[model samples]
Target: MIVTKNEAPANISKAIGQENVTPAWARAVTSFPPSDRILSTILTRQAERYGERILLVAGEARWTFAQTAAIAAASAQALIDAGIKPGDRVALMCSNRPEFLQVYLGCAWLGAIAVPINTALRGFQLSHIFRNSRPALLVVEAQFASAIESVEAGVELPPRTWIIGAAAGASDARLSAVALPARGAAAPAGAVRPGDTVAILYTSGTTGPAKGVCCPQAQLFWWGIYSARALGIREGDVLFTTLPLFHTNALNAFYQALLNGCTYVLESKFSASGFWAAARRHDATVGYLLGAMASMLLAQPQSAEDSTHRLRVALGGGVPPQIHGPFRERFGVPLVDGYGSTETNFVFAGRIPPDRPGTMGYLADGIEARIVDENDSALPDGEAGELVLRAGEPFAFATGYFGMPEKTVEAWRNLWFHSGDRVVRDPGGHYRFIDRMKDSIRRRGENVSSWEVEQTIQSHPAVAACAIYPLPSELGEDEVAAAILLEPGQSLDPVDVIRHCEGQIAYFAIPRYVRILSQMPLTENGKIKKGVLRDAGVTADTWDREAAGVKVRR
Candidate 1:
């Protein structure tokens, strides 16, 4: 029953196409009927059909579908025994480990909500999530437990709490031991329905502040269907993920593979050097990547061993337009870029196709995506406008942000959710991302897109990384400013950087000033904190501007 690329089951594509289906772009347009089922439905199906097949791998431990389900059920019973009721939130603060999935499925099995916290968050950021989620319990690894304990002291929480892998240490005694029940009567025989809230995944805190985006179980299922088809994840597909599970990219991708009954491999942390080794070890046919991760990998010296891995697809988000062709050429794998957020799951995903540089594929089936002006009027194709998505089919649409009615209302305004990201639809109906609402520069009656500027600057050999934002000008308005990171041993002259931009970018779009930085400030999810950079003010002291050929012109 090995489900290889050539031997995929006949019903695989059909089952995935049950939703709002579009044949043109190859995707499901709508969500299926609400099911009174947990994520375990996929697990149980695997155990019944593909028995004894490995479902999960972490470190040296391997778990079959049956064993994994049993552990999940047992853990669910443990939560119920510890007074966790249905809909109660439980935060999972652990790295990429077997226990993370075990605890996540355990929560789903019991109809409780699982909030996976980013492990990279510490201090204030961690406290904000703890307070926002207000989880009744926390299932944390021993290493992060201490950080949780320190944060827990000040934050107000639910009456009960629990931590995994830690028996009882003097650090946080209030965290009681909830002994996992041994194969107890299977979760009272009920399941979390499609519309019921399943989890509260927080948004990347790049703009203002992080707000919890509510997602339901059904959304997961629908997106899982789309993802499985788009990425071609099959029953025996070995999928590897090193991205933090807290992000929607990892969570959806991981669950999509699980729903496909694919073998999943988890790494505690991502390492550029060891990535290929791990993929080869697991025989991974598919994996996940972020644009930043891809850029980092491409920066490393190439080796003959690069193309030897079994990875056929790397489904991910944020693959920059400039690097798309080069990355695919170097890696020999098609990079399928998907567009989504915590509030709305995978609205549009680029499916598996021959290498097409800089395209994020056509709009996903059943999804009604459009570019609209500030007045909410639809703009003509190729005009930059705010991206809006209407749920063409039912899947996991959020109940709304937790306790933030104003924010929720604003987000879901005009019967269309404002994505805050700008985009343009091409002649063939393909969408190209422009810049975030906050990142687009308004200068001298002209709109300058930062993405276009960054792409141009990135073409330079010494430009390793770059961020473009609006800077205050003497004209009483803001103009484009650039911050760049240089390659090792490479020195940059500001004039040369500006001159390079003049040739590639439009006159108005070219940066008025170029700032060289040791590194760009990044969010936990690796997106640049452009707002922070703007607030800090791009001053001469912050950038290394060699005084040669630099000039100020009106």
Candidate 2:
């Protein structure tokens, strides 16, 4: 079932039209029904078909399709016993462990909502999600207790906290007698419909707190199908991921393999140094990369072992334009990068032929897309504007933002989901992603909210106001930078500001470059003129902590 170079085009063409697909590909796509695409039924069906096939690998533990399904079923039963009903939210805070999937799929089985919290969040960032989602139960791991414990006092904790694999002598008493229910426990009989809201995934907001994107069970099913087709995923492909489970990249990767009857491998976390070694060990045929992974892997000394792995098609985004070719050449594989966000499904598909180095593939099937001006007027080909899209087919995108009706309405305005991204469409029909119109900062593959960072830095009484934006990083991606205005007769220290921010937000989100300005430039509408600051760039006065050799640890 391995897709050869000749056969790839057939698969690609079947998913998207032949004229629209990437120039060269080896896999073929098969169509699935548009409805009844429930996550539980899809997974359960995979188990029934694949049976003893090695389905999931985490560390040294190898789980067959049946074993993984059993764990998911048992976990669902445990939640039911704990008083979880359909639509009840269960917050899951963990890294890239297999238990993450156990709880996630378990929630899908029962039609409950799984709220995946970013493990890096603390204080206000973490508190906001808890207060907003207000889950009845929390299924967390041993390591993430500190982050959850940092939640503000007023933010109510989940009524019941169940720890997964607590280390011996762990201080939290919740883990003393509790264990994830055994795998033999029977899952209750329930109808899993495609439109059931299985999860509430939070993404950094432009204006306020993080907004939860309410994704239906069908979205996950379609994500896998679309991603597999785009990536040219083949039978026997050992798909691997180091990305955290909280992110859709990993979750969708799991589904990609599950639906295709391929084996999946999950590492504890993404490690640039050991990434290839892990892939080699697992005989990975396909995998994912993000942020500096392409750059970092290419930065490693060129070796004879570069092309030794089973990896053929590596599917991911954020592969820098400069290194995109170099990476493919060095690794002897095709690297497919595309544009996607939590709220929207994969819009521009994955493959970008070498000739079109920067274009995020053509507009996907069943998606109505446009590049529009500020007034929502459609722009002509080759003109840049806000990228807006809507599902031409049912259940292709998220239903709405959980508990944020106003934000949802604003986003879905004029019958299109405003992507808050600037893009251009060529006459040939390929879409090239431009700058982000939203103020949300993407650092190290993490969405760092400018508003969240501003509020944290504004906590310092000396700071009158702050404007956060992305600055170019040595690693190709954007780095967090803040332009600050101090109070009259007051001063601020970059080191102190960074130190204070260490626990308040993720380490990656802390501003690496700090600039002191007399006043933040404002627009005619009295909004912070971020474009003015972004254009200003890092001035001579900007202080760089990396340049000063100051390291802040988690």
Candidate 3:
């Protein structure tokens, strides 16, 4: 049913604290008309509706809905002045800040594609993104200039580089460095379609370089709507997030606020000690967190301020089921577990006050999910297999992997996006996550590619062969583990293995546990038996980087 402004359901009205809030499911079935779903259009509409209401807060900087819309328009003018055109790729590498949003929103306003790169990416990983995306312009923080310089020898970076912060002494001969241009006169929003690509979010590849998930204009609109519904966001509520803006979680939090007529706050980074204080300071009613973040907060010494925050709930996906009750009891805020990826929308979410603690909530409306076997045959309920999903709303999910047609086809085979996550749906329709079916490790909320880690480890002088896999972490999620075979007659220190990986990959992707083996277990075809290594797990001889007092800093 097409719900108009006056026909909002009473339950949704109570949930959002407003009578005009549109339910996401209703928006999905109505074709998500471009005038309503496109980012530029959404911003314009919200600005007109909300007027001067505060829309975004980053540190001490604040922008109202109208101001944000103006910033986006001005940013679009700046991009156009820099020679950016519709559909051109603009690479952005920076920490969470207002400039990131300005650039992202500007891209949306101008119909350009924003490619937000993880700031921690360097060397091989960073170079691969530059080579693959081939962005027309690079907008990066001055602090990350060295990262770009590190890869300049091999990769042809964007033709122009615009530095965000102080770049006085950070200049490089190879880079065409220039100060970030001032915002130009406001430009009109572009005529963007719902299916037009808005952003290219790169997710870790299991056996290859990271693939850029092409997020369409309407997909982000759905993300804003669906995620707001999942968090039970209300009008005039303050939504705060410490997650990086480069990822989907934080970016969508902005949308959640935009669509729900709420205020959004962005922190520079996550700090377990200061989390509650910040929330209380902002008078935040809703928050966002990953599973590992919940564990980190639990590890902090309890204080009287723990339950003092106004935050009533948080979108806590991947949180360990065991800690759900305890976390709520101590913090007085319930964590809502759900299932989502860069390639998918908010597909599964638990109830507000969940009946089941650990399971990913019942499948969401406007989507179809199936547990499928190796041959793509659907499995019965209660049987664990790869979870595949299909969205009913057009352009609600990511279109495909940019520049990787083969990977796109492989992932979207049989008309369903292969999640590569093992899960089982009970008769009651609740889904429980099993394990990852693909060869990837998730550590501290970052997806670590086994292929990328193995490649980095194999580059060490004394390493002959290596297999990277996941070992269960005490703080929920996985800890990267490396099983290595030494080169003949060559001696290698386990600590050096980590030192070798220092600048080659992300700090989270570095091996936490290293086991040096004399010989690798092999298959009939001479392939290294990674499953055997994973099953062997952390052995007595495993050298733990944390236990040895080795620290890796970003």
The global C-alpha lDDT for each of the candidates, from Candidate 1 onward, is 0.68, 0.79, 0.86
Which candidate has the highest TM-score of all?
A: 3
lDDT of 1 by residue, 392-497 (tens): 6565556688767888898888877888888887665567777668556755434456776787688889989999887664332466778888999998877777
lDDT of 2 at 512: 88
- Tell me which residue pairs clash in candidate 3: none
lDDT of 3 by residue, 1-554 (tens): 11001111236435445456665434442534645688888888789988999999997789999999999999999999999999999999989989999999999999999999999997889989999999999999988988876673767888888999865334556678787888879989888899999999999999899999999998898888778777777778899999999999999889888887889999999999899999999999999989789989999998988898799899889999998999999999889888899999988887778667776886766778888899988888778889998888889899999999999999999889999999887776778899888989888889999999899999888989999989889998999999989989998888898889988898889999999888889999999888888888778999999999999866
**How accurate locally is residue 471 in candidate 2, as Cα lDDT from 0 to 100?**
87
* Model 1: colliding residue pairs: 20-28, 20-29, 20-30, 21-29, 29-366, 219-396
The TM-score between candidate 3 and the true structure equals 0.95
Which residue pairs show backbone clashes in model 2? Answer: 8-25, 8-26, 8-27, 11-28, 11-29
List the candidate 2 regions with Cα displacement exceeding 4 Å: 1-35, 167-179, 350-353, 524-526
